[model samples]
Target: MSYRRKHTAQTFITNALALLFIFLFIYAGLSKLIGMSVFKDQLSQVPLTTQAAPFLAWAIPTVEVLVVVLLLWPSLRRWGFFSFLGLMLVFTGYLIYTLYFSPYTPCSCGGVISGLSWRSHILFNLFFIGLAVLAILLVPSKSLEKQQ
Candidate 1:
């Protein structure tokens, strides 16, 4: 393929991936924001989460919404990608922590996906993070250098 064709294909893929991430994040975030009881119910299934459940119940969804907003903008897409990756890393850490230190199995996340083992949760977030990273890398930088 010519350079232009390759660039177009990459851009299409990146935009599609971003849209998918944005949709899922926004939906999940709205679900959390709309129903605290549902979130609390899900939290009860996880052990350590019970302690910090309230804060996370409110915070996670809010952050996800913000990340989606940022990712949708051209100027802010890089920041969004970085923020998303960071959040996913934190999520991975939480899953790992729950798996090893907490006594209870992780609860269903947001009542959307059910019965995800801690390992599965980590891998899922890792996969999304990887996709976000790839999308960020594919985005064209604004600056250009003139040949000497």
Candidate 2:
């Protein structure tokens, strides 16, 4: 394909990925907000995160919403992709920790994700992480474009 066609395709792919993240965050964040009690309670059961659970309980959804807002603007899409990737990485790390180290870890994640087995959840996170990475790669950098 020509550079223009390829660029357009990549842009479409990246935008689609961002839209997916937007939907995921809105759905998950709203679910967490709706079930605040259950989410906070489950977080309290975790061993290492017990103390921080209260803060994280609110912070997670807040950040998710913030990132979604950033993703909506073309100018801020790069930041959104980075922020989304970081969140997914942290989530994946926790899942890995829970899967191997924590003997009786409870799922505090809101919505349908709470139903996923630890192993399946890890896979799920990996998939989203992949999408974030793809979005990051496909987003054209203005400076680099000019140099080329």
TM-score on alpha carbons, each prediction? 0.80, 0.93
59-132 in candidate 2: lDDT tens per residue?
98999999999999988998999999999999889888867887668887777888998899999999999989
> 61, model 1: CA deviation in Å?
0.8
TM-score (C-alpha, index-matched) for candidate 1: 0.80
- Model 2 clash number: 0
Clashing pairs in 1: none
Off by over 4 Å in 1: 41-51, 144-148
Instruction: Give the top-scoring candidate (lDDT).
Output: 2
Per-residue CA lDDT of candidate 1, range 1-148, in tens?
A: 9977887897798688778788878877776777777777667667777787778787788899899998899688778778877887887787787778877764546545445666777788888888878987877666621221
What is the lDDT, from 0 to 100, of the residue 47 in candidate 1? 72
* lDDT by candidate, in order shown: 0.76, 0.88
